[model samples]
Target: MDLVIGRSRSAAARRRREVAERRTRAIAAAAGVTTGAVLVAEVLRVWRRGDAPLPGETEDVVLAAEQAIGQTVEVAVAGYKGGSTRENALLNLHLSFLATFVLTRVSTRLLRERGRWGPLRNVVVGDHHIHHFVPGIAMAFLAGGVSIVSRDEDLDPYLAVPFGAGVALTLDESALLLKLDDVYWSEEGIVSVQITLATLAMLSALALALRVLRRGEAEVLEHDHEIGHGMPGMVVPVPSFP
Candidate 1:
């Protein structure tokens, strides 16, 4: 009887902690959105006052970025089909963003209604609704920081998890960020869905264009394969990029 009682107490305590975590995450999300608004306002205020720093001043601020990241940037650039680091990063960021959006939509649909068992139950903490974006935001920063310092390309896939998660969470709160109020279930909340869909469409279009361009380049190379032969029975391998 004592053992059963102890187990019950532990479970109760764990439930309380989970409830507290959900509340904490909700508060943090609110604070983050508020802080972002204030920062944007500050930047606009400075710009209007003509107090913004010069373009060169901004360059100096990030001048040490290359030195700080060391060879990570080079490795990313080299791996990106011979594309520049900026291009590679942007492409991956968009792809991850779209993926996160799709995931959030599916998970939200599945977890909106409660169940007695399975992973969907994990979405709710006590009576409080826990957003997946909360964990996503944390993971994104943790993984991004690790990827920045590591030179291994194999670890790059791990970096996508956080980026994708954080993005989904942020996009779901898009209405909150824009209106500075909670309107997630109302008509206003629909704005978040619209924005997420539009962004994904644009990113998909860009990715398709890039693929077509790559295919065209490959076809051009194939034509050259026959013309570039120097000797009979000699085989040459084409170089691969990215």
Candidate 2:
């Protein structure tokens, strides 16, 4: 009877473990979907509507976009349009971080579960095991430094790519960073996942709040332009909101 009881307990425990894993995966998938949707929407907005005013360019594109998206959505778009270069740079930084967080978690799961089925599992350099974080870190620093010294609007997206990748790699080994030891295969690895999610959530909320708060100002300025009171032939340089 004791042996039978032990067997039953083990089976029950296994089911519970499976359920927990499924729940975690579900949450991660949801986060990934949400992040991808936001990124796609932002990119589509830029492609379809163009960017904020550049030097020697008029604000017509921004105005048109605002009109197309309507008041609620337009307010945020307008606020972004009127934002300064520094604001745009900060936005790029936030997006890169968020993207990295999502991608790292998802990729780690995929590689762990499906590694044997694909060539992805064989990636290496000679006898040394290549860690994605190494290249990610190098790219991030290189691009980040370049962005800091220069204000080229076009460079922001380029910088975001490397920075995001670097962040993902580094965060995947978040346990190592905190404890100075490799605990990636242990429960401690989840620390990186938690930090990534928390940071992304906070940054996203802050960005949304800033945009929402700027709505009234954006509307007022837009109203001035509509009434023909806005400055004509004056070019205000601003970064793209993406």
Cα lDDT listed for each candidate: 0.54, 0.61
lDDT digits (tens) for residues 1-242 of candidate 1 = 99999999899866765665565456446544754664354334323323234345466534333332332232223335555444455566666666676566556656555542355555557896665556766777777778888866666654655675676667676776677676654445643364446456444635643543344334433333446654457677899999
**lDDT of candidate 2 over 1-242, digit per residue (tens):** 99999999899866765665665667667766765676456534433433344324555766655543454355566666666655655666666666676666667668878874344563678897666667677877888788788968767755766676676666666676688766554445564455456456545745653664355345644565655643666676788896
Give the clashing pairs for model 1: 81-242
What is the alpha-carbon RMSD of candidate 1 to the true structure? 20.2
Top of the candidates by TM-score: 2
Instruction: Give the C-alpha lDDT of model 1.
Output: 0.54
Q: How high is each candidate's TM-score?
A: 0.46, 0.55
Candidate 2: residue pairs that collide: none
